[model samples]
Target chain A: MGEFDLITRYFQRPAKRSPLGVGDDCALLAPAPGMQLAVSCDMLVEGRHFLSTVDPARLGHKALAVNLSDLAACGAKPLAFTLALAMPGVDESWLEGFSRGLFALADEHGCELVGGDTTRGPLNICITVFGEVPAGAALLRSGAHAGDDIWVSGTLGDARLALEAFRGTLELPADVFAQARMRMEQPAPRVALGQALRGTASSAVDVSDGLVGDLGHILASSKVGATLDADAATGVIAAAASCGLGTEILRTCALSGGDDYELVFTAPPAARAAVEQAGKESATRVTRIGRIDAEAGLRIVDASGAPISQRFGSFDHFV
Target chain B: MGEFDLITRYFQRPAKRSPLGVGDDCALLAPAPGMQLAVSCDMLVEGRHFLSTVDPARLGHKALAVNLSDLAACGAKPLAFTLALAMPGVDESWLEGFSRGLFALADEHGCELVGGDTTRGPLNICITVFGEVPAGAALLRSGAHAGDDIWVSGTLGDARLALEAFRGTLELPADVFAQARMRMEQPAPRVALGQALRGTASSAVDVSDGLVGDLGHILASSKVGATLDADAATGVIAAAASCGLGTEILRTCALSGGDDYELVFTAPPAARAAVEQAGKESATRVTRIGRIDAEAGLRIVDASGAPISQRFGSFDHFV
Candidate 1:
């Protein structure tokens, strides 16, 4: 089939909220008055972002979910998104499974597929998502203050543990591997927690990279450093129980594990109860594992406040 | 350099019109109160969309130009765009040239680069553009009338000529080849003309996949057909003068050329003068090439009104 036929069969839908949707040269969107449009784009490539052997359905889910994580970090309600997909050739079952996964997540969030482009080439999925946040209400990485408490929503390190197991660097029990693999394939974006923390949280960012590396972005933007309690951070890894790993493994994975679509945020110490309430309301686990500091660089500390000497580098595409 | 550092050095910039620019989870934009947002996306894959030997700077220009053409077809004023690019590896000179070409066009239209993604993968560039049009004023492909005059802005076929020459299917003199290659590399988008024809035109579409195929989209959307004046269409290909091509070659290339990023539109016969005035104001050449009809499919006829029998298929990625 041709590109248009492929689009019509898989992606086209009636526009309900926006003025126009698929089939038009350009989809039309009008943000509600007093609302600012939050836009973000993400591209996923085989072997780099996902394994070639991954399920097509999960791949689609992960592609859109990653973009949605950015919207959640900005505390923006989902509106619409454009998908640009490049593939090797036509695969009916792959397209069906992929669209099913993509639309399931989209429908859950009320995000419409507005417009997109499909081409034949090496597999690449790029999504540019749009969301709406009220004027002056968006939570940005620059909003954190030195005295704010750093918190992370949901669990981390499971995705990285799965990667390690998959790479044969570490091994897990069969059942444990399956659970970790699920975490890697399908990350639950902390959208509700982020929306709930809007006015209560001082700053926010979704952790796709390692906690320390992603947190460094907030520090650089907000001009403040952080002190992460290594023990407290390690305690949040849910996979630690089933994996029979050492404390060092747990700490390293939890602290520097990328691919965790959890929110790492900060709020003033006085609003700790409010942050806890937001987490409770969103049905997400909130863990306090760090604090913003006036210092210039990150500092990792044990329970007794002593420094750790080993350095766990985060994932970087190029170095 | 790492991905973050690459972004910082090349794509990061402070927000002037947007509430938030690069250093955040999402870039925030607030469209004017009465304007509706127009969104479109296009993906360019290496080997499929362009030649490997093409200039990197021109490749950047062509990528954004094609996307902007979609906005132009919708009669939307340029606002902003996001680029998601994947490359095999970092090449400083390539990035520098690409950025230079991209920013030159972006600055011309006041379309700021708000956010994007970069990764290590097979080269691909996906751009999602945002434009704005006053409510109820944007042109659409579904608005054509049975008796409307079909028009084309600027010349066609030169880009196809350049392609055929490069493929060794045809040949041209050195000067002629160079000129045609420029058309192939950097076909100008009819942005100003589209904005100018906002109210005067009945329906519009940018011709990327040849005149007949792109016009087919208008016909299908409007539930109308058209009789294209093949002679007039062939008369508009400027490359004919130096290419030493016959009538058959000119007609085929002009009607089925896929890379010419020009506008094909329709207007009522009474608005012929107004269409010319719009073209004049926008500094573009306008040609009346066909007429919409009540029939069910496209018809091509010579100057003598005899129907043409040859078939010229348009480009399709999956076919």
Candidate 2:
């Protein structure tokens, strides 16, 4: 079948929520009246974003999931998305698996696949997701203030733990590895949590580049520093304790290993009750591991409140 | 600098027309109330869409222009776009040139660059553009009637002529080659013409994959056939006559050579005057080259009304 036919058969669906869908020059979406449209794009390249042996279905899910996480960070309601794909050649089985995984998630979120381009090239998936938010209600990275309590949804470092296992830098029991692999391959986007925290969270960002680095973005954008409770941060390591990682290794992975799709947000201390309510409503765990400060740089404090001096780097595509 | 820094410095601009711009996880755009969002995506891969030697600025312009053309065909007013780019390595000079061309066109159309991802990989550019159209005003591909006149804006075949010359299959005067190359690399998106033709045109599509192939989309969608005036269609060849192409070559190039980025629409005879007025207002030439028919397949008739049997193929990535 031709490329267009393949897309129509697999990716194109009756865009029930959109004004128009695939098979046209452009898809049409009408955001709810008085709402602003939130748009973001994310691209995944083979070998760079995923292992060569990764399942097509998981890859597809991850591709859309990452972009959706961006929407979640901004407290936008899932609306629609477009997928631009490039592949070395046509493979029906691969396409089937990929589309199935993609549509499954899209259906779950009601984010209809609208329109895109497919071409012959190295495998790359680029998705642009559209969502909606009330004017001035979006959770931005520039809104955190001094004395705000910083919170993260869900545990981090599991995806990084799985990556290390894949790279043979670490060893784990089969069941433990399986759980971590699930985190690596299919990290859940905190869309509900974001929407729930819309009014309470002063600033938010998804932890795609490790906790320390992603949080750095909030600090830089908000022009505030942070004091992280090292012991509380290390609580993420308990999820990986079955793999027998030492404290130093666990700390490194939790701080800088990357690939976690959790939401790290900030709110005033007085909003702690609202934040907890949001977490309960979203059915996601919330952990307060830091506090915003007026100082210009990040500081990690030990259990005794003694400051620790250690540098952590985030993943940069060109670095 | 890192990839994020590169994007901030080169791509991030104050989104004057949008609710929010590039720094946030999702860019927010609020179209005029009651307007539907028109969205389309196009990806250009180096070595497939353009030669490695093509100017970075033109390559960037073409990447966004092709997507803009899709919106134009839908009769939408350009609003905003997101760019997802992957490249083998970072080059500051190349990026400078590319961003210059990209922003120049974006500024002209008032389309803001919203948010996107940049990663390390083979050079590929995927742009998703958003536009606004009044409810039920979008020119769709399924609205053509059998008696409607098939019309094309601007011209065609020049881009194909340039491709052939680049591939060393044809010879041309230096000046002619330059002109054709410009047409190939920098074809203008007919945004103004598309908006002007909104109420008058029944159905429309941009001519990207040659006139025959793109028109086929309209015919297939509208469930109609067409009878083409071969002589008028071949008039596109006159523009390339200075390139020393033969009649057969000219006909093939004009009918099936892709990448022209012109608009092809169908209108009822009664709306011909309105179509002409739109053309005049947009300052673009519109040509009526054929008529939709109730027959099951496309047919070309010569000046004397004799049938011309020639098969034309559209450019397919897989084929």
**DockQ scores of the candidates:** 0.91, 0.88
- Model 2: how far is A18 from its true place, Å? 1.0
Tens-place lDDT per residue, model 1, A229-315, is 988888888766756798888888888999998999999999999999999999999999889999889999987889988687777
Badly placed stretches (over 4 Å) of model 2 are none
Docking class of 1: high
lDDT of 2 by residue, A1-319 (tens): 7888888877888879877778899999988887888899999998899998998899888999998899999999899999999999889999999999998888889898888899999999999999899988999999999999999888888888889889999888888889889989988899999999999999999999888989999999999999988768778653586667787778777887788889999999999999999999999999999999999899988778898776678999998
Model 1 chain B: which ten-residue window has the lowest total lDDT? B238-247
Could you give the fnat of all candidates in order? 0.92, 0.87
Residue B211 alpha-carbon offset, candidate 2, angstroms = 0.9
Candidate 1, B78-145: lDDT as tens digits = 99999999999989888888888898898888899999989899999999999999988999999999
